[model samples]
Target: MEEKKVRIHLEKHYWPDEIRARRKRNLGRILALVGLVLTFVFGWVVGSTFATGEPVEETTDFAKLEAIYQIMSEDWYFGKDVLELQTKLIDDAINGMVDGGGDIHTSYLTSEEAKQFNDSLNMGFVGIGVQYYDSNGTYIIERVFRGSPAERAGVLPGDIIFKVNGAEVTGIGSDELAAKVKGENGSIVEIDFLREGVTVSKKITRAPINNTAYGEMIDAETALLEIYTFGDTTGNEVMDILDDFETKGAKRLILDLRDNGGGYLSTLETIGSFFVEKGGILIQQEFINGTTDTSKSSGFVTVDWEKIVILVNGNTASASEVLVAALDENLGEKVTVVGTLTYGKGTVQTQRPFSDQSILKYTIAQWLTPSGKKIDGIGITPDVVVELPAIMENGFEPLEEGETIAPDSVHVAIVSLQEALSFLGYDVDRQDGYYSPKSVEEFKKYQATYGTTVDGVLTQEWISRLHADVARVWHEE
Candidate 1:
């Protein structure tokens, strides 16, 4: 029997320096070849759309583009598909133009990828509802949607997936894995995962996930409204939640926008109207030609809340930032922003689908708050900056197996570890500065999620990973 190679692929973030540098070199060559053409085309398109009333010169020479394509087709070291190569050339040119400007939010999506992106905002898909990312050498689960099959199957953040449907997937990319995991509604798929060094198998049935926006009363007068992303139906969902809050007599509201990467611009306006005054500017859009437009709120304040606190983090971006700023500026003292700095994103992108079904999401305008605050590279500083400081002994050795730090034998490090676990969504009740059986159980769960030895003993690697995951959660939040 022939042996198969087990290939380990790391994400770009974990790529070696040489590999990244080589990629940059290749990218530079492609950019250099197509830079002029892209610039000319972009300018011409913009002029045609807006009609600046001034004549623009045509300086781009198409000969260079033809020459590069010819060289790649004939003299390239490998066999090439001219059609695919042309598509790639056009896509790369647009991507380079957008990326070169340092606007990470603007992107170019292929036909299939664009459909997936649109599907995320349309409603939901038939899948296990776990978001995974490629890490060091495995596909690590990043998030499990609430009430999802993955969550029901006990999938947790940091759990490493080993196989799908009896096929080894260690060498597959995250996108391919996602496609494999998703199926027709009511279909079943098998998953093998490594948790706490134990191989666990699960059979999860695919179903529609529609909990994009949801809320619950945290207390008699406090409600926690979590908006995962602003989408087509987000306004209606939020309105329904507000009605529910009114019915529940919840006067205090906590808007949780943590980990929300934002969605539709029209949805922002619709949602903003609930709090902002009627016909007030929600966000100002400034174009490249010194022109500006404003998206105004409908001024239909529905639910009345005396106190409102918005919980945001680095992942709160774009439309999320717009909503936060609108509420804070319009409502004044009634609204307060809590958490770390937001994920500074101030540009509004316009997605234009081409004839081939591909989509080009290009930055068309820079957004500003109603109060004229620009939140681009510099994120919006929270009114209350909350952070968990990592307190660890410089030379303290990690607790090994069988080396217990029980109630009688106390260790201050235990409290810090407990706090970390609690922040990472582990069931570590409270940071009582004691290593109890509860702590041991949660510690084991963390170990399982990270595929570490389930000895209930914290290792140096575990501590390091805990710190890193904490940072990751905050940044991705």
Candidate 2:
């Protein structure tokens, strides 16, 4: 058998001790991610080759394959096409990655394989399937979709795949891994994974993934929307939600953009256009030649600008950040953003097809807003910041070390809320230790002014505004 070798390029730089330590910690997380995104790809390769599939009469045909490849390389000449050279090279490289798997969830694809693998994400697949990614690597099956083949096969969320049909699939990429697991409908794949620290093997059929990101509100004006990514349909979904809200007399909106990573930039641009008025910048996009252009809203052609209050957190990234930043900048008077700093991702990426089977999607440019604000590494700050609940506020959830909020919380929160209301120009009674309907009503009135959901609940937003540095009074300004 002919052996293949790979060359890895490294950027020239000296690493610090802290960076090394951080990398060490990041390694496990990254591998775990590989276990998810690449899990399917690894599973297919291992299962097809192993997993009781028309049992192989002979273990492998690498020798025969090598002979065939040698003949193609030497005889089958399209006259030394450089394109042909790269194709052959990429094919060898991908096969090597798949064969090097340590777990069923990890597999490598050649550029072509990677393209087929990634495109499959939008095409077809099934099982109690879930997909996720991180800086560490790509992941899958955080939560199995209900009624999926994987779910019926007893696969639970967070079940880590260490192998598939005896092939170790650790550290595989998302594009590659997705390619591995996805097959034509009615195809069967065997997956070996660890659940609750116990190793298990299961055969599951693949199915199409039907995902929805919008969750409707019942009694409250706040609808919990969990966008997995900003795809081509994302803008339409958002617009539909806004239409629903307006139809139901929703004067205030809380856009929950937690844990959503970015996808299509066009979706963000479209969504931003719905909220911002026309002829104004929504985002500043730079072209490859260094020419910068701004994506502006055609107008407030969809929803009212002042009615949205985008809720963000550490996991909110990419398209989510774009929407949040746009609303924050354009609807400052109407929007009262709350939650933690966002996952700042202001870069643009485009996918370019190589061959019939492979494609490459790489980041092209970093983005800025019309105001020239950068959101790349430095995340967007919330207008009002509220720390996550250290422990259950009602003291009911499981308690662990370093979890519980101190006893001084209630007094502190009440005092802060009172102070914040005053700072935001609420005419509430002075510094009252108690929360009465009067206080609540006064907070509601202030919220009404800024278009927050007027449930009359003394939320952290109200408390935050109390603690904020007051802007000058309208008359004075």
Estimate every model's Cα lDDT from 0 to 1.
0.69, 0.53
lDDT of 1 by residue, 1-477 (tens): 885432111001111111111111123334443433353132233444432333433444555555555555566444264445555555555555555665555555556666766666544788898766554335767677778888898777756678999998865765678789999999999999765456779999999877678789988999999888877678898999898888888899999988777777878888899888788889888889999888888877877779999998777877788889999988899999998888787877776555556555666778899988898877788999887343322212345433455442357667767878877778876576677788888888877775546887654445545654654464355
Residue 240 in candidate 2 has what lDDT? Answer: 80
- Prediction 2 TM-score vs. true: 0.49
- Candidate 2 lDDT, tens digit per residue, 1-477? 885432111100111110211111112222222322211121234434323323223333543334444544665445276445534443443434433343222233335444334333232344336543221231324445434677678765545555654665645764456556666677777777643334678887877664435646655555444555565466676778777776765655667776566656666777778778887678887767989977788774654533666777787776677777787787777887788887676666554443332333344666887788887779888878987532111111212323322222334344445555655567767454466556667766765765557765554323323222221121122
What's the lDDT for residue 24 in model 1? 13
